[model samples]
Target: MLPTVRHLLSQPDLDLRLLTPATTLPERALEQSVEWVHSSDLSDPTPFLSPGQVLLTTGTQFDTEAHGDELYTAYVARLRQRGIAALGFGTEVIRDGTPDGLVDACLADGLPLFEVPYRTPFIAVVRSAADMVAEERYARHTWALSAQRAISLAALRPDGLSATLSELSHQLHHWVALFDASGTLDRVFPRDAFAGAGLPGTSFETVQREAGRLLGRGQRASATVLAGGETLTLQTLGRRDQLRGVLALGGVRELDAASQDVVTSVIALAGLALEQNHALAGARGHLRAGLLHALLGGSRDLAETISTEMWGPLPSAPVQLVVTDAPAGRLDAIIEFLELRVEEQPDRLFFATQNDRVVLILDRTGRLLLEDLCRTFGLHAGLSDQTDYRDLPRALAQAEQACERSKEGEAGVVEFDDISRQGVLAFLARTDAREVGRATLLPLINHDELNGSELLKTVQVWLQHNGAFDAAGRVLGVHRHTVRSRIELAETLLGRDLGTFHARADVWAALLATASVPG
Candidate 1:
């Protein structure tokens, strides 16, 4: 490490002594390693001074009578403002000694002040600091090279990005995270360390906003955030103003140039990985679409052969067709997420996008993955019954219809069977169903409108109660006799027998169909 004030004071040959009280000097200040030394004969040296430097002055300009106490105090304050590690005063040049105003100013500001005897030359101090700085730089170079090698080897592992991040986290002894362009957390080293570090509640929103802005510009940007009593640095991952993602590093430490080089290399690798994945996804999407076309055209044998070569043997019996929809803004993210899932488990599914919807031919058991994805992405999805590859066209139609129905109902997922409607009569097209519903209820609707009778309410309540007059009456806040009379009137007006289960079922379907229609 570079030499600090304490290190210089401890060198017996240097003959340096602390003029500031030991109690007054903080441990952080004493441990600060000086990067260099600056010797100035001028009074105002703030412009020349930099951080992590020990300022050396011979007190030749310390004329209390000429400069006044206030001017000396101002000079000392300026040195502190420039962030000098410490101030060294050389005695014997001034007629008196170190000015009391300078000493008082250093003490007030907690700036470490030490005295240099005339016997010691400032050049000696400069030499000691330079050697230490060079040694530290070399050490950092060695460590960075080793870390880069380790990270590179880890990236070659089968696990790829996860393994690379793990190795980096281990080497730095800090948490590392990667986020995709959509601002989703793609991976985090040490598992749940990000949450443990209190980052989610502290700076997650800011990070997401900045990440989105940087990604749009395809540029590199960074922000420093404080969380869990430690600093985190969030940086964009890109090259030449093309951003693919963002990276987060917590418990940040000052990195040397060599270490920063390793970071740049890692960022490059990550960007390349993302680009390759995107290209592969596009190619796979085309293949999946082609496969669907073959199956829909009744070329089952060709489809199966291609499927076997790419994603293992096709299910001989039947597979489920799933359709998914998301908002236009989130459509790309949802598609990318599905593509990743397909790549990770190729045999489980194959998917392609059609317009605003994603269609998938997946094993029956893959429903859970779709359900979870729907919830995660706030998507609406529809699933069809298992159908043979030969019947994929029909199955796809069913799934598309279900997906649209789910979206209309604002449901997360809708399975073909969940609607409990079989064959063509289950539910017709929107206009047809509305017309049929209006016809079915027209007689009773007109009667109630003309006579202001409670027949429609009574029939609906009776249907809910399964034709039980007493239960229906209780729900309607009326007596069983009144409910019975209302139901009879409804039956007369509709010219149907409400006593039969099939008849009531028909009326129930019509009621649901008209529930969403205006009178």
Candidate 2:
């Protein structure tokens, strides 16, 4: 603990009395740095004065011997210009009395003056100040070590995570909570502090990003909780600064430097505990990556493996397959976020890619859960039917295809089956893929579209009507002669008659191909 100013003043070896002095100056005067001290008998002490110095001089220096009776008082103006810490005068050198002119000058100018009487050597006083500060630093370093040991023991005890945190809080005198990667409060020791409170705490998704930056810059952070009144957050980082957790102190008194160290040590210990927890949970986590690979490649065994290992033989292994548009390592954090969210549920499982596209699994209906996950993790997901593992790959494929069709799909959410076509949509999707398809009919479409002839429109209308020309003309809003002229013009461009079934089929396929290509 750092010694207070009162402690230094109370030192026995320094027999200093406050001459012309009272007890303490106002609190605002504490911030000044000491500049220099001198014991000179010159009448013009003001010339030697510099800003921030606690000028030490004998009382003779304040005498009006050479200058007028207002001489000592005139130094106040120069002292104010110097902005010194305080003027110290040895009372023995000037008859143990402070000059009235100096006293009056100080009160008028607001310059503090200290009267250093006999029996206390200035060297002894300076030595006492140095010793006090040095002792304070030593004490702080020792306390830091003791706290460090406690942190080490906190990680080793393994008595439940809550017990460890309780021990940690006792040592640091603060409330501690271990939040998993999910925003939910996984463990809050001394549960009474937040037992009924809906404040589950913010997620590592938010905290880690911030804590990581602070640790990266070799800085410690602290904040007051506006929501919880005196509640305060004093956080730094833990083991390799992995952002294990945050330490909070809620009290009316401000935390001292020692308290800050204790809280930081607790966070470091909590980091180790959490990393251990993660290792323990890794086996359960391995399925997510495998699930992602399986869904992407449409592998059956991978899905079955996930089902048997995670949500075994059940009535309905309700699941949603999310498809991410990224490759790898780019979205590890989002995948981790999904994992943490799923971990909260009794029977939820999720697999996601590095690009943040994901598949989430829950036993019951997942509309609420999916919405929560999307809002929490900040990733849009294509919701799919909750079927058994057998259908996951297909659901994922549909979601991905739907994503391709949605203009805003890259925003990272898409649902399969919803984007798929039916009837004319389905026919249009595959219209140009048939063997007697556009590869053989492109020349026909090119011929009609390039020539600006109405033949392509006529054929499209005729095909819609199943080859009924007058009906097609009615749909086209043109006369039969006009439609026939367009067809004749199309035939002329194609160097083939439009009467044959093969020629008509070619024109139909070409039109489909032209429409199917994404604009």
Candidate 3:
């Protein structure tokens, strides 16, 4: 450990005496580390003094009345602001003792002050402090080297990146968390530490947002978020302009050089690990595509063979199928999300893209698991009842129909077993539906488009509520008067009385027909 103010005062050979009593100086201030001892006669020595320094000076310029006591007080205040450990006033300069004004100022400021006898040269003290600092630095360097080796070896273990993170957290005495490219938490050391803490609550969102901005600007970036008075640093992973993830660390103070070295090593190891995982995922994607082609091409034997070889055997006889039609422009993100889930249960879960839809086949019990994943991504999906391996073709068709129906309502999910026979009308092809929809409701749609109106919505709501204006208004969260006016406008544009049975049925079908249109 580096020497402190109290340690220097206790050196009997140097004959140092404390001008400020022990009670006046805080225990923490006495134990504060002193990295170096500096001697100066300049009026403003703050410019030359570094933090954690013990400043030694004589009363050469202080033995006067013209400069005033406030001037000397301000000098001590400046040193304190610069983080000087303590002030040592040498005796036998122009005066045989320390100046009364300086002593009073030091005491008033609560700064640690001591008297250095004339026989003890300032050079001697400087040498002692420098040696102590050197020794501490050497110790830190050795520890850092040993930690780096341990972390590197852990990176090579079966647990790989997880082991590296565990070692890093242990060495640094801080919380560590890693997130993937999707901003999803991948690993955290001391796992339960963030359960009730806000370190990764809102701080994670800020980190991801910062990472996006940094990637756009082609610069490396770090964000410091304070959580419960602890500082959390979020650093971008991967090279500039190609961020792969984010790494976060929480600590009470800034990290020392040794701890920082461990962080850098972890970053490098994580980058390499991420690259390896990416390559492996690509290879697996190719294999999955091949297996999917085999299944769809009606080669059951080969499909079963490949699946059995790569993954475990298919569930005995009864497996469920799930088909998804993601929100526009979010298919890639949804796929990434689902892939991560699949990786968690490689034997029990399998998914691949067929045509424009994502198809998943898992054990019967895992059907609900697929539903949860789709709901998490806000995706529209259709699930089929359990069926044997030979019936996949029919099961897939049912799942596709169910998925198409899912787009008609707010639930964003549908099971073949849940839909009524009449709801089958929702499975009409988009081309045929659009043609009929345009022929029946094109006038109203065009009118609404041109006038920026909610006439169409009013008509749909009115039909949904069995043509009751008050009921529809309540559902629309509007007054009946507004609903009546919009319905009247829609009737005029369509040239039909929506109150009639045939007109009501036709308009309802047309509204359902156009419900699948992309916004």
Tell me the number of clashing residue pairs for each predicted model.
0, 7, 0
Q: Assess every candidate by TM-score.
A: 0.79, 0.57, 0.77
lDDT of 1 by residue, 174-221 (tens): 777888877777778888765633356655555556566666776677
Stronger candidate by TM-score (2 vs 3): 3
Candidate 3, position 124, lDDT: 77
Write the residue-wise lDDT of candidate 3 on 369-444 in tens digits: 7768777777788888788777888888888878877886765668888754445444453326667876788887
lDDT agreement of model 2 with the native: 0.57
Estimate the overall C-alpha local distance difference test score of candidate 3.
0.76
Superposed Cα deviation of residue 65, candidate 3 (Å): 3.9
Judging by TM-score, tell me the better candidate of 1 and 2. Answer: 1
Any residue pairs clashing in model 1, and if so which? none
Which ten-residue region of model 1 has the weakest summed lDDT? 422-431
lDDT for residue 319 in candidate 3, whole number 0-100: 79
Model 1 TM-score is 0.79
- Tens digits of per-residue lDDT, candidate 2, 195-217, equal 54643453323333443344445
Candidate 1 wrongly placed segments (more than 4 Å): 1-3, 7-13, 66-72, 93-102, 141-160, 195-220, 238-243, 298-318, 326-347, 420-426, 429-432, 435-452, 458-510, 516-519
